[model samples]
Target: MNHNEIGIEALNQGEIEKAAEAFTKAIEESPKDPVPYINFANLLSSINEYERALNFFQKAIELDDTAAAAYYGAGNVYTLKEDFMKAKDFFEKALKTGMENSDLFYMLGHTLMKLEQPKLAMPYLQRAIELNEDDNEARFQFGMCLANEHLLQEAVNIFTEVVKRDPQHADAFYNLGVAYAYLENKDEALEMLGKAVEVQPDHLLALHAQKLIQEAK
Candidate 1:
């Protein structure tokens, strides 16, 4: 098997050392190819070796400026480091290079949300949901973006879908409650907040919201 494939197999099998050895050999054999470097970078990133992963991603990008995987890897490293601006830049670059993946859209949307640019985040989050409708996290984030944009009904719809798909999603329930409250549906809000606290007893926000709604009643 090719060194890269062997390296991938080793990584998947959780043989870190063997995977590293195979990836190193793959890089040595194909220094000009960006794929091995990108794969190694991803492996390093997965293991929390951020600096090394960034270096490998940079090397891959230097080898092939159009390498979308390199840009995406670099974006992930920056995101893990909480450098949201840098993450957004690299993610945008990846998109500019025609890298279209649910993860790419999700990360870019999440980065925008982190930057408090919810208006800009909406389309990317929507794209992520479109690409993977079952991604509850993406749907939750999309709901948040919609709420931030003052589209309470839309936010409620997304959050409802999230909670329906994953009943144990306390955060989704909490947000759904909040959206309902904003829409002046006090009964539904109380019900959802109660469900949120039931699902996660220590969900402080949900508890607090439920108490306030009860007091209001």
Candidate 2:
């Protein structure tokens, strides 16, 4: 029906060129509307055209200053560019614009973690988990942040939950082992590390950890 609707359908079908054409038409029809610009920006971001995507997002913001999606899109582009600090700033701005959701919280948390601000990242990650408990990647990252912050037991608990949720998660097992070792629980560390190696026989870190623990005994 509408160009915007057609663009969204084409985007969902992975027809990027068609989607772009539809979105361009939508923009020409409603030049002052920010939605098409934001949608186009999202498509560009998905294709890794970070600079052009950011420019379109800025254009959306210029049209509607309260457009939270534009800020979120800009933040996602910055994240792809590995500019974690700028990503954090835009994500924060999105939140201030009343765009509060699990994804927003997760991105902010993840960016803070990348910046090595684990303490600052904890609350956001916690909120993200509260909003969406099935995000094992977020859970694993939060566990790592806990371990880095010296919260050994809590880290172990989180890692244990991760392994329980996905038994084939070799990295979760390895992290659990590391957390146990930090707590001086050598036996548990060995057990978890052994499981890690069992799950992924080519896991060099797990093998090394196992060797170190065995020699220390």
Candidate 3:
């Protein structure tokens, strides 16, 4: 196989040194090719070499402006570094390249959420869930966006689905309890809060909510 293929195989097999070596050779052999740069950047990111990874991603982007993977990789590195503004920029650039994937949408949405732009985050998170219905984390985040917008009923529906899909999701139950309480359904709120605590005995929010509701009654 070619060096790039070999590098990818090594990366998948958890052979970091071999992968790095193969990717370096690939870059040496095809200096103008963006693919090798993107692959190497991904490897560097996996190993927490954030600055080096960003350099490689930038090289790939310079070689090919339409290199969506390079943009996405840089976005991920920025996110890991907690540089949400840069992450948001790179992720949006990836989208502008016509990349439509659950992960890309999810990351962009999550970055917007980190920036406290939940209204802007909602559509991307919704698209992420639509693209991959089994992604409960994306669904949960979408629910959070809805709740942040004060669309509590919509948030409740989304959280309910999350708990149905993953019964051990303590946060979903807790959110459901909070939503029900806001909607003035006292008994249901208490029951959902109790379930949250049952699923995760140390869920402090759920415990606190339960105490408040009981004392109010």
Candidate 4:
């Protein structure tokens, strides 16, 4: 296989040094090709070289504006750096390049949520779930967006689905308890909180909520 393909395989196999060497060779062999630069950027990102990764991603974008992967990679780096606005910008650019994938939508939605724009995040998170129904994290985040908007019943329904899919999800149970409490179903809330505590004995929020409910009785 070519150096780029070899680099990708090595990266997938967790051979960091081999992957780096292969990617460097690939870039040297095809300096004008954006794919090598993008691959190298992804490698750097994996190694936590955020600034270097962004530089490589920018070089790839300079080589080809249509390099959607480069934009996505840069967005991820920005997200790690906690630069929400830049992350949002690059993610939106990725979408404009016709890259319609669950991950891209999820990243964009998550960035929007970080920016405190839950309303804008909702549709993208929903679309992510539509594209990949098995993504429980996306579903959970969508439920969070609904809860942020005070859509308690909808949030409870989504959180219930999350717990059903993964019974060990303590946060889902905690959110379910909170939602039930907001809906004034004290018994259901306590039951859900108990489940949360059962799943994660050290869950501070579940413990606190349980204490509050009991003291009120």
Models ranked on lDDT: 3, 4, 1, 2
Model 1 C-alpha lDDT versus the unseen true structure: 0.94
Q: Any runs in candidate 4 off by more than 4 Å, and if so which?
A: none
| TM-score: the better of candidates 1 and 2 | 1
lDDT of 2 by residue, 112-210 (tens): 999999999999988889989998888988898898899889998999999999999999999999888878899999999999999999999999999
Model 4, 121-170: lDDT tens per residue?
99999999999999999999999999999999999999999999999999
lDDT of 3 by residue, 90-136 (tens): 99999999999999999999999999999999999999999999999
Q: Clashing residue pairs, candidate 1?
A: none
Using lDDT as the yardstick, the better of models 2 and 3 is 3
Weakest lDDT window of 10 consecutive positions for candidate 1 = 129-138
In order, the Cα lDDT scores of the candidates are 0.94, 0.93, 0.97, 0.96
Q: Better model by lDDT, 1 or 4?
A: 4
TM-score of each model, paired residue for residue? 0.98, 0.96, 0.98, 0.98
The residue-level lDDT of candidate 3 at 122 comes to: 96
